[model samples]
Target: MSRVIIRLLLTLLFLCPILAHSQLEDIDLKELVAGAQEWAEENLDTNVLDALPELDRQKAQKFLRDLQKQFQGEYVINLAALRETANTILPLLESHEETRPYAVWLRPRLDYLKIADEFLITIPPPKVEPGEPAKPIPNPGPIQQRAVWIKEVERRPWPPAASNHVARLKTVFIAEKVPPELVWLAEVESSFDARARSPVGAAGLFQLMPDTAKRFGLSLWPRDQRLQPEPSARASAQYLKLLYERFKDWRLALAAYNSGEGTVQKLLERRNARSFDDIAVYLPAETQMFVPKIEAVLLRREGIKLAGLVTPRD
Candidate 1:
């Protein structure tokens, strides 16, 4: 078995019970395995898959079953193992142009995995009562995560790609009547790599999803306009401006940007909440971390708080 297969198998074995207990009991495990196998066969390079020594079919099935779960799990601790897997897979993904976009997706997210690992090591778990039913260990809240990212982002030098792209991208955002400082969003989304693409179909420096790109008048066919820096930045700025108009707060607008507007809206209505912090805990773990990470990035790169950002006056 390839080391990737072995590691995934171990992770699936270790996390299956935890996953089953945590709201995923209704999922059909075999179906998930089949789906992953199908995706790998279709989308991944045949040569790359062949290079990974084959595992027994049953073992491969078992390992692949929870592969997505391991990456998307709500728990931060689960991410520690994936950091190694991502490191191993990155070079392989970069080896082929056909798969390089997936590498772009994974590269920016590696820091997230690293930070989650450090979060597990550095932050002590919450205390439980002696006789209380054990509960999932909660991830650090937005304020705590902001502090963590402040330290994490401060130590790193600016991404080299940012120097080449930020000026041009800022001009696009300004033309769209959005704050130029918000152009740093590309740093958080794609490290200013215009070629960046998410596995789920988001693309370009702004990482605009097809639906959002289309809604903003960008074309998906005859070439994905999302991969074009200027067009995508214009779309992104328009979307962000619309999100801000809906939410009225930069933090809430950003939370909507990451998690979807309906998600933030539903949570707000459900909780009778208006602020991001009020509904932050109920949001997906990724979005919970995302807004603060953006805030931290803005502060580090521009010396501006999220609240300090202002859309350009017409």
Candidate 2:
């Protein structure tokens, strides 16, 4: 009898709150979980079809499932975190489709990705001499001249404000010695357009991926901070700093930014190549084209004939 009473007490205690809440709010945990899962799966499938290779598709799909399992205990989906993971796999997404699917499930995540890209575009790493600065040499080798041209093309320009914004960026990119001209890279990248978005889902002035932005400390929460020019630029600078540190070459860093870091890393591993032109051939088609575009733009900006070439969009 005592045992039965204890069991009854336990049941009442457990049931009372649920009954009360059901009457007042009508919450359904199972329904909510099902809806979230369905939404996630549909979105994952779209990304898989649009951006992944067959082998990578399988891996990415499994990763998404793992995300679901990882978040099963939580009631709400942390879309920002999940989206970051997805953007890292974007290179895999390109072969399958020319553009991102604009479905509701995919749109928000892509928006976040764009914000990240913009942020990364703005901030680049500092340029540092690998060793103690040698006394100014009378002449660098042939390789040095080519490296200088490569640096000239990757430069980013300061925003409208020359002193303030430019100085701030220099601080974040402290890892390596940055060329002064390459500061314009961000300008050509998105015309300092914070809200800028690429067709393939790259976004902002820096045009960082969602994952890259988040990894570099930009928040893609309800609203992504990457769409803000100054902040995005700072983030982009930070990411570039990391890339330069890893590759120790400006051209390779730029190429890595435009294409998959993985692809560039693999190429570097396989070849004894040191020049951007050599490594560039192994990169994706878009990146090969990217270098020349940057070069042309820089040339135009510096030339007197094209004095009024770049005008801010209204």
Clashes within 3 Å, all models in order: 0, 38
lDDT of 2 by residue, 1-314 (tens): 24355334433322222211001122233443456455445433233242445677675565555443323312111323455666655445443332232121232234323322332343343455788554321222223333443444445444453344445544433322443344456555655445444323345656765666666777665556667655676677666666777877666777677655665676666677766656654443334444444554456445411122231222
TM-score of each: 0.78, 0.43
Kindly list the per-residue Cα lDDT of model 1 for residues 1-314, writing each as its tens digit. 46575434433322222211112223332343335445433422233233333442233223323333443335655556677767777776576554566577668778777887887787787788999876766777778888988988986778888888788888888888888999888888898887776544466888776667777999766567887888888989998999999999999989778767776787788789989989786665566677888888998988999999877777
Q: Best candidate per lDDT, number?
A: 1
The list of candidate 2 runs beyond 4 A from truth reads: 1-180, 299-314
lDDT of 2: 0.46
Q: Which candidate has the highest TM-score of all?
A: 1
Error of 1 at 155 (Å): 3.1
lDDT of 2 at 180: 32
TM-score of 2: 0.43
In candidate 1, how many clashes are counted?
0
Off by over 4 Å in 1: 1-73, 128-133
Query: What is the Å distance of residue 99 in model 1 from its true position?
Result: 1.0
